[model samples]
Every structure is written in structure tokens, then in C-alpha cells.
Target: MKNEGMERLGKDELSAKDSYYINVMRGLSILRVVLVHLGLSWFYPPYSQYIGIFLPVLFFVSGAVSYYSFLRAQSVGEYLVKRLVLVLVPFYVFAALVLLITVVFYPERFPSGIGVVSWLLVWPNFSDVFFPLNQVWFINCLVVMILISGPIFFITKKRPWLLWGVIIFSLVVSLLNVPFPLYAAVSEYSFFSRLRWGHQAWQVLVLLGLFICGSVHYRYLAGQSAKKYALISIVFLIFALMGYFYSDLGFELKEHAKQRSLYYLFLSFFAIYFLLALERPILRILARMRSLEWLLLYTNRYAYSVYLSHTLVLFYVEQWLGLTDLGGQPFLALVRMFLVLVITLAVAKPLGDLSRTLAHTVRAKLLNGIIGGVRT
Candidate 1:
């Protein structure tokens, strides 16, 4: 029993090498996310088509990390509190700051009087308006996924086949084009219709499936031999290429749009496998470049902040500098993307540092106060 307990602990703990590779992948994903939001329509083909792979990879990494986090947490309440502070607090802080800027400068972009109050009281919907806060839908969805992850982890652990079963069921539901009244009702209420339980069922289901896939990959595949991973990776890469070039089946499935088509699901799986296979070789090359390695690590550390804040920076850049006019020109688009990335990193890094400090201080104070009260 003691040996088994030790083995379990070993399995749950991620090695430094594995962690480093995952962080690099996260940095790459965040970069792709910024590019996608930059409104570079011409950038989507050939190279950017590969960017679609990043979302599933991100979801997978999140699942793996969340599972480890769950194991370390003393209780579900503690796990939730940490997630709320780490994820939601930064999101709300950044969101409110963006909303304030819009209300003051771009008043027309934001809703008026009672509508503003209502939107704040409920969740801000990304679909309703062209607000900087729209990008935060990812964070909102993540929060929802984390809330339910404990049950998911248990189910996946006890009945691995059940996880695949759920995935198939979700895929079938997506194909059926099932109508949801609750989705329609809430969608009318706010742009954040995806946050409505009934509206985003298929999306959440697919994400959960992806999340499970990530957990399983980290647990099982991460330790495999290079030749084995390479072989698997090649197979998935071929399938992904075939889907992208030959068929539009998965092209319609976009997470941001809350559409999880069957083709997109397969595409995401293939992309993930290809990425995992490349991790070892990529890390070896990155290790040789000390400066570039550090940069990626730093970016990954503050990726969430970068993700939340980049759109706002991009919006202002476009408004002030007229970057949108150069949209179709490839060179200008590359320049614009570079500028947005640099400016966003500058703003997001400082904001992330400040938010982390504030969150830590607040959490410490609250815990101390509670302990003092108990003593009293």
C-alpha cells in the first residue's frame, strides 16, 4: 500500500522537462491567438491554418495542469478558490478596466445607463457588441470547465471508456442540429450567450472531451519512445493535412463561435498528436538558445494576461494608427501583427505582474483574517 501510494504521487507530479515543453507550447498558442484576433484574414491560409491546432493544444495543456492541481489541492473548496483568484480575478479586473475605457472614450461602443448595469450584473456577452471584453469568453469558458473538472477527473479515472463514450455522444448531438430554447432566450439577453448553460452544451462537451484527451496524453503518451511518438505524429499530421486540403467538414467548427463540428474535432485531435510528437525535438533546439528560451518561458508565465489584454491594445492601435487599412497587403499585415504583439507584451507583462501581486496580497489578508477570527 505504501509503495502504491508513492507510485501514485510520482505519476501525478510533472517533471521539469515536461513542464518546460508544455510552457513553450502554451507560449506558441498564445501568440497564435493574438494573430488570429488581429483581423488578418489573408493570414489564415497555409501557415495560419496551423494556428487552429493551438486551441485544442491549449485546452489539452489546461486539462493536464488542472489535473495535477486537483491532486495537490487539499479540498475542492481550496481548488476552486485558487482557480477563482488565479483566473477569474485577473479576467474581471482586466475586463472592468476595458469596459471603463470604452465607456469613457468609445461610449457609443458600450451600452447606455440601465443596459450597462444589466450587462455588468449578468455576464458580458461577446457576441452582442464589438467590445474589447469579448476576448474574455475563453476565460469564462475555462472557469466553467474547471468548476466541473473534479467530477470529470474522477469519471475518467474510474471508467476511461466512458470518456470516449461522452465524446461520441457529444459529436452525435452536434450533427443532429438540436435546437435549444434556453440558448435562444439567453442569446437575446446578452452577447455572452455561450455562458448560458443550455446554449453552449455542445461546445462545453467537446472541450471536456479535449480536456480529457490532454490528461490522458500527459499521463500515458508523454513517456513513450521518440520513434513511437514520431510515427503516431506523422499519421495524425497526414490526416489533418487531408482534412484541411480536401474537405470543409471541420472548417465550420470553431470554438470561439461555439460550433463544434465533427471534422474540427478530428482535426484538433490530429493537430494535438503532431504537437506532442514534436515537443522533445523542439525543446532540444530551444535549449541551445538561452535568450529565446527565457523569452518563451516568460511569455508562458504571463500568457493568460497577454490573452486577455492583447485585443484591447490591438483595438486602440487600429483606432489611432489606421493599421486596418493595410489588412490585405501581406507585408503590412506582418508589420501590424509584429507591432500588436510587441505593444501587447509591454502592456500585458506589467498588468500581469501587478495583478499577481494584488491577488496574492488579498488572498493572504483574507486567510489571515479568517485565522484570527477563529482564534478569537
Candidate 2:
């Protein structure tokens, strides 16, 4: 809570209004992440299908938030250091712990064993490989977005037109069916291809588009008409859904073709601008719930941990509860959802806290002995 020595562009923290939006969006992102994990192999139509549509918005919000931090930081070094220490450090440690657990306990998933240190070094594996805590793709993507936001901010600073052009181009790419090859050695039958982007060019372009939107938000949108921005968000959403649905009409178009660049762009704008647009109403509703605030706050803080661990937890929980069989019974799907939601929150949050505390204690002792001679 005490963000000392963390100076930003104009303020040390977001405005109360801005904080409200951030909190709401953060909560929404976490909710979707949970839903996706639970919905896996569940209902196939409509609601069961929107998980893909829902998760990308989190990335857009991430780009927006990271861009805000980038502008506020005194220097690039400060930005990178703070983000990595606070965000990336916890992510990597928790992910590694997950890998350790799966290899030790659920060896069926890790055929190569722990000796493949090189695999851990690569991030795409965070999504493709299900060792222990497997839902870490968002963190990896956000890390990539944060690292590049600076150059994006600088490049699009003076040229607003250029930024829009890049966004539109990325949107075009999203509408087209183009596979970005990341690995050639993997068997074409391998599941790894699903996780790897065939085109880094489009990925970076889309990230920049989101970054620009986030930057423009700070520079201009904040003080402007919330209604207008909300309308923009709505219009973008309509186009996104159109792209998503229409991609199947052509051979060159693929289902969910709106993913890479266009999806992040549209969803980022939709979540952010609409959030600002609905600031007053949302806060009033959320403020009424006193006890739930802690729950929301807890999720916001340890969301990365929850995201990392939920899949493995679900793996065990499904087996124990026999909920996967309920996929045939639509009503039972709801019951399973409720059960998974409760059990996951109960298990993941505390486990995440314990993991962080242990890591912190170990680091503290190691540093104290080196710096203070055991407090003589």
C-alpha cells in the first residue's frame, strides 16, 4: 500500500476515480481467467465458448496499465526494475515451483524431466506445457508488452495518425489467416503450435496499438468526455465480434481470427474506455459491499498466482469431484462452476500467499547476512 520512492508523471498514484476503474477491470480479468480454466471441455456453445473472447481483454488492460507506468516512471531503468521485481519475479518463482511440483508428482506431463533447464528458460512453454502451474501465459505476454511499451510510447508520441495507422494495420492482420511460425522442429502434430504465434510482426504491431491507446488515454482521454470514449469502446467491440464471427466465411479466414493484434486492441479499448465511462456507477455499486472488498483486493494482488496455479488445481479437483463428467449435464456445469470457483479461491489464494512469504523470507535472510553480518 505504501508506494514510497515510486514517482510517476504527475502523481504518485492513480486518482480515486482511476483507481476504481483499475480495481474493477482487474477483478473482471481474474474472473475471466477462472472461468476459462473451469470451462475447459465444458459447455460448447455460447457461454462455454466466450473464454477465448474474454481472456485477451486482460492483455489489453495490462498494456494500458503498463503504458501508464512507463510514462510515470522517472526513467526506463526504474520502470523495468520495479516491474520485474514486483511482477516478473513472483511470476517466474511461482511458475518454477509449479514445474517442480508437476515433474515430481505428476510426471506424466513432463516426459523430459527436470533436466531440461532450457525449457524453463523459454516462456511460450508457460502456456503449452502443463507441468504444475500452467496458466501463466498472460504474465509472459504482459511481460513482453511491458518491455516494448517504452519504445512504442516514444515512437507514437508526436504522431497520433501513425499510431492509428498501426492499429488499423494490425486489425487487418487479425482479419487474415496467417500463421506465425515459432518453431519448426516440433512435430506438426504437436500441441505447441497452438501456443506459439506464427507472426511476431503482427503481435508487436497489435501490442503497440494497445500501448498507443493506453498512452493516448493518459494524455487526452482522461479529461475528455467519458461518453464519447465509451461510444468508441462499444463501436470497437462490435467490429471485433464481427471479425471473430465472419472469419469463418472465407477460406483465408479462420475461426477466432481476431485474436492476435485486433482482439487485444478492441478489447483493451472496450474494457478501459468503458470503465472510465462507467466510473461513478461501478464504484457506487462496489463500494456498497464492505466484506467483498477484501476478496476483490486479494484477487487483484495475487491474481498472477491464481492464474498460474488454477489449472493444476482444476486438474486435481475435476478428478476428485468428477465434475468433468458433468459436461454433458448443462445444469451441472453451473454447479461445477460454483464449486470450482469456491475451492480454487480457497486453495490458490492462501497457497499463493505462502509461496510469496517463503520466497520473501528466504531472500531477506540471504541479503541480511550478506549486508549486515548477521545483525551483530
**Would you estimate the TM-scores of all the predictions?**
0.79, 0.72
lDDT of 1 by residue, 1-376 (tens): 2344344435767767778788998887787788778753335554455456557778888877887776666555555656556776566567667678767876777766654553543346454346455555566567778888766666565454455665566555544433443324433455544335445444565567777666666655566666676687677666555544443444433432355544565567776777777877788888798777776777788888888878777777787787787645778767778888889888877778878887787667755665576579
Clashing pairs in 1: 125-191, 125-192, 128-191, 250-264
Q: Using TM-score, give the best candidate's number.
A: 1
- The residue-by-residue lDDT of candidate 2 on 1-376, one tens digit each, is 1232123234534566555566666766786778766765245554455445445556555655666666566556545544544555566566566667767876766635433453444353443355344455446546666677666555654563355665565566554533443223222324544545433333454445654555455444554565776788799788656654554333221233233534434655565566667766766777898556666666777777666666766676777777776656878778777776777677766667766776566555545554465346
Q: How big is the positional error of residue 123 in model 2, measured in Å on the Cα after superposition?
A: 2.6
The candidate that achieves the highest lDDT relative to the unseen native structure: 1
Collision pairs in model 2: 9-72, 180-198, 180-199, 181-198
Q: What is the TM-score of candidate 1?
A: 0.79
Q: State the lDDT at 312 in candidate 1.
A: 76
